[model samples]
Target: MSLFPEDIASAARAIIADYAGKAWMIATAESCTGGLIAGALTDVPGSSAVVDRGFVTYTNEAKMDLIGVQPEVLAQYGAVSRQTALQMAAGALRRSRAHVSVAVTGIAGPGGGSDEKPVGLVHLAARCRDGRLLHREMRYGDLGRDGIRLATVKTALEMLAELG
Candidate 1:
């Protein structure tokens, strides 16, 4: 059995199939979801042709070092903000050979909730080398860590498909 939910697995398969048809490759930059977004895509057979690389930037330093997320942006808007997500997507595209990229940054928590940025809040961004970009802010409200991360993965995959 697949580790991901059926819906997620199905979406991943569709993304790989569609992108592969166009001879396009994909890259992922993840934070709160860890590498689940990449994991989902790589789970599908033949994904080797479609997936280029994945960056699990769980820390501020990793974001900057691995994907080139600017330190100023992270300081100004924090890691989970739209700015960071956008930079991450752009950075993934710049850093990889992939034709498209998706990025996710968020607070998936049981204890990290604050009045302003609560648990289950996620920001996602996707970019295409053709100059297309997309962003989504999801407020999944306290669905617990695993739930929030999985939800982010699903949405990230959807964004990638949209870009493709």
Candidate 2:
């Protein structure tokens, strides 16, 4: 199952309430969760005041083109690595008018497991306008695609809240 809209919106509401008229805007760069992180935030009423834009950079090329993720980073650390996550967050902030940015890159699967990077491994990064950056690495251990994605959305939103 996907994320419940109400649950997602509830979290989003806190962010909306906090940032509205505070001159804060948010942006998202998503990978394994697609655009779900942005979707959840948009579900809340009055989110327009806080949400700037979202980039669904599902492919390495898209990450590089849409958000300015360095191709060398993708080649060296892979898309799901911490370096890429940091770059994604920075890229989102650079490419948008948002004051804070959150980025999600992960492998949520039953097929993408490996000795190094297993399934359900996610790297999340949040960057604030003041240059504070936060990174969290989650290993949900085969929570299935939807479960992992939903958790990612929740965590990404929470990070945005922290940044705000």
Scored by lDDT, the top model is: 1
Candidate 2 clashes between residue pairs 3 or more apart in a chain or in different chains: none
| lDDT of model 2, residue 164 | 76
Candidate 2, residue 66: how far the Cα is off, in Å? 0.7
Cα displacement (angstroms), candidate 2, residue 67, comes to: 0.8
Residues 1-164 of candidate 1: C-alpha lDDT, one tens digit per residue: 67899999999999999999999999999999989989999999999999999999999999999999899999899998999999999999999999999999999998877888999989999999999999999999998899999999989988988888
TM-score of every model versus the real structure = 0.98, 0.95
Worst 10 residues of 2 by lDDT: 1-10
CA shift at 113, candidate 1, in angstroms? 2.0
Candidate 2 lDDT score relative to the true structure: 0.90
